[model samples]
Target: MGLLDGILGQVAGNPEIANLAERIGLSPEQVTAAIAALGAAHTQPGDTVAGAADSTGLSPDVLQQILTHLGGEGALGRLGALLGGAEGADGSGGLGSMLGGLFGKA
Candidate 1:
């Protein structure tokens, strides 16, 4: 569950994330499980997402695709969840290309 590990690593280190379980109103164990889910979740452009999948050992291409579709708000959370969230406010992955196709900055 490398993806999950990365997400957890990020969450654990979050200055704003006091207690994920507490904030989410989930038990510590449940929080762990959720983190695990994030790890297992997969994204598209298989090549780009493969390295993360290999590390996280997750298996949910569909979810990843959905997350990609969701863009900044959704995909971003997932990306931050995976990339430790220190990468700024920008969400993970390229939503522009995935959204309306490559057409330069709107």
Candidate 2:
């Protein structure tokens, strides 16, 4: 599989994709494409759903459904983590560090 496909698989497994595809009335492949498009659009400034819809040709409403299914705004952060954008220079997993900080760990 390609890098993006690998990331997608890690982010949303087959069962999740199948459920989302069925709910959105889109094929699993299309759902995957939409997820990728949303991830790409999220890197930019402004409305993610609109940008994803423009790129993927899947209406904003559908993209919104996908976004909500993927866990709303927090999904983008999770995607970024999967894409390696969440690692610190010290190699401490970003989310792990944040949670550790919350618990007063050194």
Question: Where in model 1 is the C-alpha error above 4 Å?
Answer: 1-7, 13-15, 27-29, 42-73, 76-106
**TM-score of each candidate structure, all chains considered together:** 0.29, 0.71
Identify the leading candidate in terms of TM-score. 2
Query: What TM-score number comes out for model 1?
Result: 0.29
lDDT of 2 by residue, 32-95 (tens): 8888899888989889999999999999999998888767767666666645665667865654
lDDT of 1 at 13: 46
| Model 1 global lDDT (CA atoms, 0 to 1) | 0.40
| lDDT of each candidate versus the true structure | 0.40, 0.71
Give the per-residue lDDT digits (tens) of candidate 1, residues 1-30: 565465455544433333444554545454
